[model samples]
Target chain A: MKIALAQISPILQDVRKNINRHLKLAEKAKKERADLIVFPELSLTGYTLQDLVPEAAINPNKDDSFDAFRLISKEISIVLGFVEEKGKGSFYNSAAFISGGEVLHIHRKVFLPTYGMFDEAKFFSQGKDISAFQTPFGKTGLLICYDFLNYGANYVLFSQGADIIIALSAAPGRGINENDAFASSHMWELMGETVSRFSTAFVIYCNRVGFEDGKSFAGGSFIYSPEGTAICRASYIDEDFLIEELDLSLLRKARQKLMYKRDNKPEVILKNLYRAVFKNED
Target chain B: MKINTVFVERILTKFIKDELGKFHFKKAVLGLSGGLDSSVTAFLCAKAIGAENVLAIIMPYGESIKKDISDAKKVVKQLGINSKTIHINPMVDAYYSKYPIQNRVIKGNKMARERMSILYDFSSREKAMVIGTSNKTELLLGYGTIHGDMASGINPIGDLYKTQVRQLGKHLGIPEEILKKSPSAGFWPGQTDEKEIGIDYENIDNILYQIVDLRKQKKEVAAMGFSQKTIDRLVEMIKNSEFKRKLPLIPKISERTVGHDFLLPYDWGK
Candidate 1:
């Protein structure tokens, strides 16, 4: 399956303009025969929406604002990010998978970073669920930016027999690493490698570019094979569209070689977690 | 503390271009003081939009160093940007003549504010945004006059320290004289930043990196071999100037006060 990573710079607080940009990129991805196109976190509403969250948010279930995306999803699948208004004054940083002219799955970001330059927790409510959903190619798990940092989120998805993990981010470019790469980008690559290798799943990481109030988003989007090697990647600090084909046979080969999923002990781990949570004695 | 100068140059230039584009501005105006910070800012602005789009205003007082003026002129010539020299001596002298103030600090502040006023006037005249040149070292230690040299429509190098600014200047291929010169505020004939601040930029930047960037405590910083006295002084300066870094405080009377609770990003609705 060919997946297109749309590393776009969303216009802040301008949902209509961002939707138009998304439509244009999706059309280009369709022409290249891509089965699915993935956009970065908050690709529809832009990151750094502090008090403007309510104005930019849309109720994905009933909002007409998503009509354009739903229409385009008939030809190809799309995974885009936006602010989801669930109830009165309750908003979530959400990603929705739209395919066959219907919303397939919605994953709200669980970890909302509140320290340093981030203020997501101030404007967004916490997400409560973590699960892998069915896609045409395989079982796929979706994670927003900070959710990927928590190993438990990826573990839950892999335990559910996910074959692909898609991590979306609007990660800011910060701190120059020794190798001249953004320190945040290097850390993301490391997570992608480790997650894909142990889970024997294809990891597709898509990040945005451009600046919002002087915060520059790092845009080194990439795809790691189940063998834990980057197959394709995009450039940093610039908007780019990357398309790469994923061979399903490699997932099988990787799983057979590593036997991580076959020898997995989720039940045993759960018992330990339950005891630890309740402070129960052995 | 070392930065990748090449990457810093690329990102800063993009920042200048995009920030200007947000407000539909294609031009920028900045006071070129012939120092490393402003020269680096001018270079970034020139590369971001174009040399023709940047305007460098050289405003000097009667006591301003001649070599600094020549260095500013050289930079303008090298970059091929438009420049206009305005002497603030008359305006500053007129104020002092009426008020009869003998304090150099007050007089120096007047000069800085006079230059700022001209830059804003030219900002409207040339239809350009006023770019700021204050580096992180000065801003953290409150070494600049509030609303004088500390005002701008946008600041690209505000987060970069003085040493990092020099590193960036070298990568931008700035003239050797500007890069090698001792940094000065041009407040007096021989006023240098270190002489007034009582600490060199390298040491200041390192201590700031520990306290501000790394969140090290004062005791922790002292343990790292930085002088406790200097650390105490720097910490006190930062504490005393906290108001300068933020908007004016508002008493919380209403349900949603402007500065207290009605928080919004600066680029909102754009």
Candidate 2:
């Protein structure tokens, strides 16, 4: 399966322009015979929306703002991010998997980071669901930026038999590391490798590029094979479109060799979690 | 705290290009003070948008050192960027002459503001944005004049420390004399930043890195061998000048006050 990573710089708060950008990129990806194209978190409205979040959000089920994406999905599967307005005042940082002109699955970001340099909790509500959905490639799961950092988020998806984990991020480029990589990008790469290796699933990370209020998004998008090896990666601090072929057979080979999934013990983890949560009762 | 100069260069150049691009600006203007900070900024700006697109305005007061002026000229020549030397002495001296302020701080502030006004004038004249040169050490220590040398459309090097700026200067091949020169605001004939701050940049930057970036407590910072008195003094400076770093305080009168509830990112709607 060929996956396209669109490391694009979305115009801030301009959903119309971003929609057009998505269509153009999706067309290019389709021309290259890609099975799926993935975009970064908040790819539709750009990161750092702040006060503009409510204005840029759209009800994907009812609004016509997503029509362009739906029409484009008829040619190629697309996984793009946006602000999803579920009701009147509730908004979520969300990603939608659209294929065959239908919204297949929508994942609201589970982690709304509110700490230093992040203010997502102020404008967005946390998503409560974590599940894998069927796709043409295989069982697929979605994780937004901060969600990827949570081990439980990835574990749940993998435990539900997800073969591919598509992680979208608009992470800011921060701290120059000893290896000449953004410290944040290095952390993401480490996490991607760890998750891919343990879960034995393909980890496709798509991070955005460009600046918003002097905060530059690190754009080191990559695909980690089930063996914890990075097969393909986009450039750092710049917009790039990466197209790479994923040998689905590797997933089987990795799982067969590792047998982590076969010998998994989620029940043990669940018991520990229950014990930790209800220690007083115990 | 060693920085990857190559990576730093790449990101800073991209920052200048992208930040200016957002405002539909292809050109940049900055006051060239012949210091490490301004020289490095000029180099990065020239590399971002072609050298021809960057303009270095050297605004020298009467008390400004001649060697500093020569070093500023050297940078312009080396980078092959546009240059304009505007003497701020007349305007600043004229203002002080009318009021007759004997304090050097007040006089120095006027010169800084005068240079700022001139940079803005050239900004409009060249249809360029005024790029800032204040480094992280100065900004964090609040060692700069508010709304004077600190004002700009965008700051590419504000996050980099003074020591890191020197490291970047070395990478950019800045003139040895300028790079090795004592840090100064050029407010007076023999004034130096170290003399005014009572701490060398090496010590200041290290202390700041521990306290600010690493979030080390005063006791912890003292454990790292920084004097408690120095740490306390730096902390006091940071606290006192906190107002300079922020937009003017607006009391919350309305439900959605400007700086309180109605928070917006700087690049909103752009």
Candidate 3:
């Protein structure tokens, strides 16, 4: 099936404008005959809302903004980002997997960056559970921007029988100059390699672009093939899309490659250790 | 404009050097503009590393004031820095002729990026890291360009407000010409930063330090007797430029990231 990666330019704090941009891009993807189109993290509310998040957080069940996405999901599945409020003051920066005019799954961001240019933990609670949902396209796993850093997170989804890994990231970073002295792309390189190696499924990375507050986003959104090759790359500093077709046949082959070690080793011993350490007499 | 000298020597300067040293970098490069921000950065770099290791480049275009050029020279001389004069008029004009940019914002941004390109190239050639001159006020307001004046390997003055940059300027014995000159990005022929932004450095710095540095909300800023428009505009600027302060997008394949994927310092040892 053809999937469209919506690498969008989100206006800071302007949820309405950003949602409109998302709708426009979804329409554009549908016109290109895409079965599913996914947007960057927090595509509706925009990243870097800071304290304004409390005012902009949406309760998805009551959100009219999501209706625009839900309506389009009838013809083409769409994934988009927005904030979800929970338990009074706590919130989650989340993505929804929508298809056939209904919300299928919502994945809250698991990792919240708290240093350098980020303080997500100051605003958002860490997501507890990973999601694997069945769709017409394939068995897809959901992860917000930082959730990809946990290799075990991908391992769990893959082991649980996921055929596609859709990662929505508001990945923050700087651009590289060919002549610049410093090699600062270390973290980004590592993250990219990790995604391809573990999941061995179609990995879709959707990133936001443009300047917000003092932080400028380096928009290098791309798709990694099951073999870890970057099949399509979005343009830097602009809104773009990389629509491609995926073959589930390759995913099955990848799973078969890792099947041998799936049952062998440490989890058996760990389960017994857990039972021994915390035996309940009551 | 009083500052704790102990903080400068013990914390800020040492932190600046330590950050550079962590990357195995030994020297710092500054595009000494004879303006308050650049002068302050030059001063801090000298103190952080040493006068000998601090390389200052006096970049002057054709339309630049002779006094500013002399003032930049004076800063380097006083700081006893390793200095170079690279006249950029030929390069800038040559590129502008070929590109012929009509939009002022785009042109200014390109010029800033071009300046950064030169600085980065020189930084590589000199084996030094480019030190940033943007202050907290500029950064918060989106007052600088990305990959141009906004880009740096390390920024010694990014946290300081523009007003505080001046205070640090005085502590570093920056010449009165640079210390007292009106703030400008020096992008165009007659562009003053205040004239463009419609706010003075003093007010911008005060509001920024309160709203951003002190974590005071917009209402709190208004209650401090500032105009509501000023507070709103400053808050908007801060919110708008938030993306400029982060890392490039990395797809979350792992459970954590340096960004939305994980949270940790680059220097955090494994």
Interface root mean square deviation of every model, in Å? 1.7, 1.3, 15.9
- Per residue, candidate 1 scores C-alpha lDDT tens digits across B1-270 of 888888888888988998999998989999998888899999999999999999999998874488888999999999999999998988988887888988888888888899899999999988899999999988898878788889899999998989999988998999999999888877787788888768888998899999998999999999999899999999998999888789788889999889876878877755
Give the alpha-carbon lDDT of every model.
0.91, 0.91, 0.74
Off by over 4 Å in 3: A87-89, A174-186, A256-282, B1-270
- Among these predictions, the greatest DockQ belongs to 2
Best by lDDT: 2
TM-score of each prediction:
0.98, 0.98, 0.53
- CAPRI quality of model 3: incorrect
Q: lDDT of model 2 at residue B55?
A: 95
lDDT (0-100) at residue B162 of candidate 1?
91
Tens digit per residue, CA lDDT, model 3, B1-270? 334433433335755666677567898888887778888788788887989998998877775477778888888888899989888777777988987877878867776776788889888998899998888778888888877888887776776677777776776677877888888777665678889768788887788877765679889888988899978877887788888877677887876654683432333210
Location of the lowest summed lDDT over 10 successive residues in candidate 3 chain B: B261-270
Off by over 4 Å in 2: A280-282
Per-model DockQ: 0.65, 0.79, 0.03
Itemize residue pairs with steric clashes in candidate 2: none
